[model samples]
Target chain A: MTLLAGHPTKVGRLAFVDQDYPIVLPVNFRVHRGSVVFRSDTGSKYMAAAMGQKVAFEVDDVDEAWQEGWSVLIQGMCHEITDPHQLKLIDGIGLNAWAGANMHTLEILHHRITGRRIV
Target chain B: MTLLAGHPTKVGRLAFVDQDYPIVLPVNFRVHRGSVVFRSDTGSKYMAAAMGQKVAFEVDDVDEAWQEGWSVLIQGMCHEITDPHQLKLIDGIGLNAWAGANMHTLEILHHRITGRRIV
Candidate 1:
């Protein structure tokens, strides 16, 4: 699929699968270059990144009244950023740690990204 | 946390984060030992597993009138089961592939498990 000229302009849901079941979370995001990025603590997302695995990122805008919606799907690799300076940069950019544990302060890392838009 | 005597009896949502946005998917799952397992095809979950990352598996029950809910959170590593024998075994278990693409026939892999229950 050809890349859109800018980040997707709608909010969407993301689903990650383990076994046959899917774990879903809601998110607000932006796409830069060809990669999709988001932030989280030492929770599930962190675990996925640590394993150096490719993940599915999805965004959708659905209108139940009209039963119509558009979605974007992202398939890519996850990377955890451990560099203290980078972590500081992420923190500086207003990515707050809302996770309920002290273990959430780890630095923001970049994810190796690739994906396509499904309209 | 202590292991529960049996699999969790409720359904939950799983979330994976990239950059600062979260990708969420709803799932039905079970806990065996310390791992949570489910099934999906060559879509998002497969991508995450290919990266060998840890993912979050969450299940919840909520009562809108009471505004109460209990959530179970799982953290673990994802491994793709590429063994043809294992693939056949998983396919034999009635795990039907429903993804909208032909690339979804990859075998079911086992996920390394860990998690906690929050009532």
Candidate 2:
């Protein structure tokens, strides 16, 4: 397993399974202190995490010309950010959420992070 | 829920779980006949899917300058492509693999696809 060298892009995919179906969606994100952070509406993702769901966050890149790129995967426990200090700090980061205007902050506490780069 | 207008980028993330750990990773892909396709080595993803695991594939784009983008997610059943005709057809597509040299083709039989655009 190769360790990712730098910061992950602010955009990536969040994956979780609800019932028997897998749920995967793109999320605008940030990595703060080894956790994956993003925003979600008062919908499936938020409700799942609020119920102490485990989730996966992944990001990858590819160059069609070079035919190479890398993929990173992180597994963690998800929860809503209610701590005032953390919320205030993230508020300062101002991750631009494009999908919904009233989305809430969700954080994935990292349990294992593993990645492999083809480039 | 909005329908995606065009082709998803050739790269995205694949999310699944094993032993209760959420696993998300980037994958080089192609959309053919309304399904998500990619490649993987003889690893966790492959082993898990070989056992009939359901998976999620997602892709999105973000423009930092505009602070707008779109994300798409597809839920599906994953399987190795063994049909010669299908493999030959996909061979012509030639989706590139960058991170690993000895990767094998894996395709997601999409069951549900949903997206939201922030732009």
Residue B74 error for model 2, in Å?
Answer: 1.6
How close to the true structure is residue A64 of candidate 2, measured as C-alpha lDDT? 57
iRMSD, all candidates: 8.4, 2.1
Q: Tell me which residue pairs clash in candidate 2.
A: A118-B98, A118-B99
How far off is residue A5 in model 2, in Å?
10
* Per-residue C-alpha lDDT of model 2 across residues B22-97, encoded as one tens digit per residue: 5776667776666776766655443454335787777777675576777677887788787888877877876765
- Name the best candidate (by DockQ): 2
Over A1-119, each residue of candidate 1 has an lDDT whose tens digit, in order, gives 22322323323334545454445443333343334444554555544543454455654433323324344455554555566775565555443222233233321133433343223
- What TM-score do all the candidates reach, one by one? 0.37, 0.81
How do the candidates score on chain B by TM-score?
Answer: 0.53, 0.82
List the lowest-lDDT window of 10 residues for candidate 2 chain B. Answer: B1-10
What DockQ does candidate 1 have relative to the true complex? 0.10
The alpha-carbon deviation from the true structure for residue B79 of candidate 2, after best TM-score superposition, in angstroms, is: 1.8
Candidate 2 regions with alpha-carbon error over 4 angstroms = A1-9, A43-51, B1-8, B43-51
TM-score of 1: 0.37
